[model samples]
Target: MTDQSPSEIALESRQAKAARLFSPSAARNRDAIGDLLAGLLPPSARVLEIGSGTGEHAVSVCQRRPDIGWQPSDPDAVSRASQNAWAAEMAPNMRPSLDLDLTRPGWDAGLGGFDALVCLNVIHIAPWAVAEAIAAASRTLIAGDDSLVYLYGPYLEGAATAPSNLDFDRSLKSRNAQWGVRARSDVEALFAAAGWAAPDRHEMPANNLSLVFRRRSPL
Candidate 1:
């Protein structure tokens, strides 16, 4: 057996290509992420995943937990192709990829509401506005009582640690002026302002942290 580079795996299809480009880490982290989700997400939850990158998480979540319905959305057409491919391959409780760009207004016109939402590594890659939009839109999507919003990614801990995150943060800023790792307190504040509250934080293998926020009020 051989491990393939993202470009090597991408040669399979358009969807695979997107997966290679965006979610190259899926093969490594999907299961760990799913473990966290299993505890947070409802048994019969409908999860709307924002920035579904390669759709790797969508497929893993649906396949591992058949009780949940997984919906993936991405703004990039090429990325959506990758997500769609995985959705077809898995054939579990999955929905087609949506053309969702949180930076725009009225983005959820046709998608409807969800019992849960998941976002992995999006906040650090995109502008602050992206995170802001997601926080605002979440209030409308989630169902009542324990409807979860799970965010997984590297973030600043107010204190600081392992030089890797500092380097990663620098790299992010270098790539895009608007992109950079955000503080945990800032993220929690966003949820709080939207009438959501944070649960306990879980540490992952990497410096990434899983921030769980749930809507406290009914829609």
Candidate 2:
């Protein structure tokens, strides 16, 4: 095929810009997530956000906390492309989106340590192994004693499962046998084995939970 003309490239850019994905859930929860992060992250902290779909949370957080250095990443090409578009309007503190896939081997090879890791609405949709991989990788990725790993998603916690959550879990499992709401206890244990302290669970809107895990000192 011949190289596209400048007008063609410009048209495609406009189309891609118009195609940036927007999640209703993100629209509803971004402020809550941003408020939490504003308090959680230290000034000038380097935060790596995984599964940054649509980049709304990243932009919101960056706008709220200019002191932070935000790096957003995703595994899907479509999501990453969308991130690029959304991230454009963010402050200079926001880095270009990285195409990082935690499930892949050597996911953190070139990347150095971060002050914190943030992942929202990702775990339950992915296979269980993704959680294990992130837990394992986080151990090495954040070395400071107070380094944090923030994960947000629906979960089966102490109280009886909310009807909405139960139905959502069922729907997930129906679509993908490997996908379903995870037991909080199971996730706690998995992270414990990876040397993280028990997460401090924060109840969120829509029956979701924000689990904040702190890094532990090496033995």
Candidate 3:
């Protein structure tokens, strides 16, 4: 095959853009997260991802891990549209996007049971109550001890993870009175109260940590 001319390449690029739903963060860390999931997630797992945002991660993860089925949800219409558009190219394992808001009731019933749950970049951007609601929703959706929930994003300990995150947290608060970076201990307590425990924590690049929580089996 010969190399395509500039006009042909540009037309192909435009065609690809027409085919897409939307664009989001193409951080190298997405694959890193996928690597973590490869080791942590079981084969043939059913994963419900909350706040799928651009749906890029959802599509990539599902494509990379054909064994796992993914359900991507977001409260925003544009996000869902983007997710739907991106998912058009993926396998059937990628489920339809749902309008899921962690703050609301009845989401658990709607979502039903899942083997695992993954949420990225939500806790730090949402309110404290929203974070609690996520834990509660996880408890309701998981049926066994082996069920896992992975949260990825920036977190703060007594010491700041990075000056940039600290500044980002402050800016978030300034922009929205309800949004701010959450502390790891506080999040841990929320998980514990919701009958989940953390067995491992993976520190990612760019001051973000991937925290995995396991739901306690029903007594």
Candidate 4:
């Protein structure tokens, strides 16, 4: 056994705390999201997840689906740090987080050929252009007929928006004018423009929705 200095012990404690950052929403929705993904994704699939916030979802989902390889990414340095720390603790299937910004051009340049792409609670908090870019990139990266693009967040469905969702959308817009719940039809149109088929929407907990879009067969 090696002796440790007090400074070393303090540093170790701080590092440990930083590694285990918590997100209440992630904890609450991870199981529901995992169940949906398990049904949609194939065994041994390669999945790339965008906006992998606290990295909690990456660890949880990867652990639940050990056969699926997971790549978690975020644009924020702090988020990447948290994801890297979580990946270090999780199974080998979880890769270290990558630096990804949906707003940037060529964001998916080197990251292609994925079996699936997942973005949770992202679009509602980002500019509409981000959603368009994501759809465009998904079309380019996912090559297989069976590949999927999975998106999860609140959405406006014509005049059927829930009261809670309306409040949430208002709060989001107050934070950033560009950020708010997107219209489902508009989102579908984005995918359609990218040569993707119409999405299948599933109702999730807390008025959130899970949209699964598939690529159309080449003519």
Candidate 5:
């Protein structure tokens, strides 16, 4: 495969910015996400954020945590373009957007490594394969046990599901058979297979959760 020249990628970014988008959920939750990230990320951590819709959180968090280098990525061209624009306008420690599709082969190639990987509100919106791909990529992109994988989204945990979350899950499934909120236990087991310990879950606003999973040492 041919690597794109910087000029080419920039041109695409300009064109795609016309497709710039906004998400109510991102606007509503960005501050909360930032608050959590401020506490979780170590000084000078290099972070890679997946599914960075509209790049809102990236701009918000990176501005506050200039100590961290943040790389934001999205599979969608529109989102990627918008991310570039956002970074250009108000980047503190934000890098240009990356073209990453977790489910695609070679997606994580050439990514040196990261101190932490963050994915917000993505899994339930995508197929199960994407979640599997996240774990698979961790082996190469995240180096050691102290590194973390942070996931934030709605999940089914404990014995009972909240009514609102159940409704949201039904709505997601209706939109696409492959998509719906996932079970926490199921997600934990999947990551364990990829050498991560069970996540420490934090309650967030709107019944969502922030799951912090530490990478397990490679044997």
Candidate 6:
């Protein structure tokens, strides 16, 4: 038997209800994202997914690839609760969502070893420093030539910028000056500075892209 405070019990109840929150976009984009991930990730890999909003993608991707161990994380408490609930219902391989903030210096603290890192529609929602932190952390966490880091979102890529993405970028900037679509060249430069190879860009169903990066050699 265990003892619990009234506040602890109340917190537990709130968390249970929180899990039901859903994201419509997560459902729409999951299948397409999974298909792309299937080709990029190894048959058996430990994958850490950052900014696991509503936990839908974590559950969906893990269900598709049972061999992959999935760690879902987000800084938001509500998102963490939602992820925990989804993991409980759908994914045996999914671990409890961790409190992760990319703006912090030691963002990767306490996370177990992982072969790959996945971030979906996150960089555009946060400041550029967040992306840089991810790059720096990936260099520290992932090792060897086979390690991978995959980023999925809309980006400004030279003259190839779609009109829709341009509009989206404008809307994002309007919301927060620091938040907007990042340049592919800028992202590649960060990865290069961290000693990772240049990213391979894959076009997705929406105007989004999947940027796959790996190390040329162990760092």
The best candidate by TM-score is 4
For model 3, how does the per-residue alpha-carbon lDDT over 91-207 read when each residue is reduced to its tens digit? 567788898776655556656678888898887777676788888877778666577989998888777468878898898888677788888888888898988865468888788
Q: By lDDT, highest first, what's the ranking?
A: 5, 4, 6, 2, 1, 3
RMSD versus native structure for model 2: 6.9
TM-score attained by model 3: 0.85
Residue 79 displacement (Å), model 1: 1.4
- The list of candidate 3 runs beyond 4 A from truth reads 1-16, 19-24, 216-219
- TM-score for every candidate vs. truth? 0.86, 0.87, 0.85, 0.88, 0.87, 0.87
Q: For model 1, which pairs clash?
A: 15-82
Query: Taking the tens digit of each residue's C-alpha lDDT, what string does model 6 give over 20-45?
Result: 55776776788888877866777688
lDDT per model vs. reference: 0.77, 0.80, 0.75, 0.81, 0.81, 0.80
Q: Model 5: which residue pairs collide?
A: none
Q: In angstroms, how far off is 115's CA in candidate 2?
A: 0.7
Write candidate 5's Cα lDDT for 20-116 as tens digits. Answer: 5566677778899989887888778899998887888888788889888999998777788888878887775889889887766678878967888
Give the range of the ten consecutive residues with the poorest summed lDDT in model 3: 6-15
Model 5, TM vs. native: 0.87
Off by over 4 Å in 4: 1-16, 217-219
Candidate 3 residue-wise lDDT at 54: 70
Predicted candidate 4 versus true structure: per-residue lDDT over 1-219, tens digit per residue: 224321100011122266656677877798899888888887788999988887877777788888989889887767778888888876578888898877766678788878998999888887887898888788777677788999998999867898899998899888778888999999999888988889988999999999999877778
- Candidate 4 vs candidate 5, TM-score winner: 4
Clashes of each: 1, 0, 0, 0, 0, 0
Off by over 4 Å in 1: 1-22, 216-219
Inter-residue clash pairs, candidate 4? none
| Model 1 lDDT tens row, 123-166 | 88887888898887787877668687889988887666557888
User: By TM-score, how accurate is candidate 1?
Assistant: 0.86
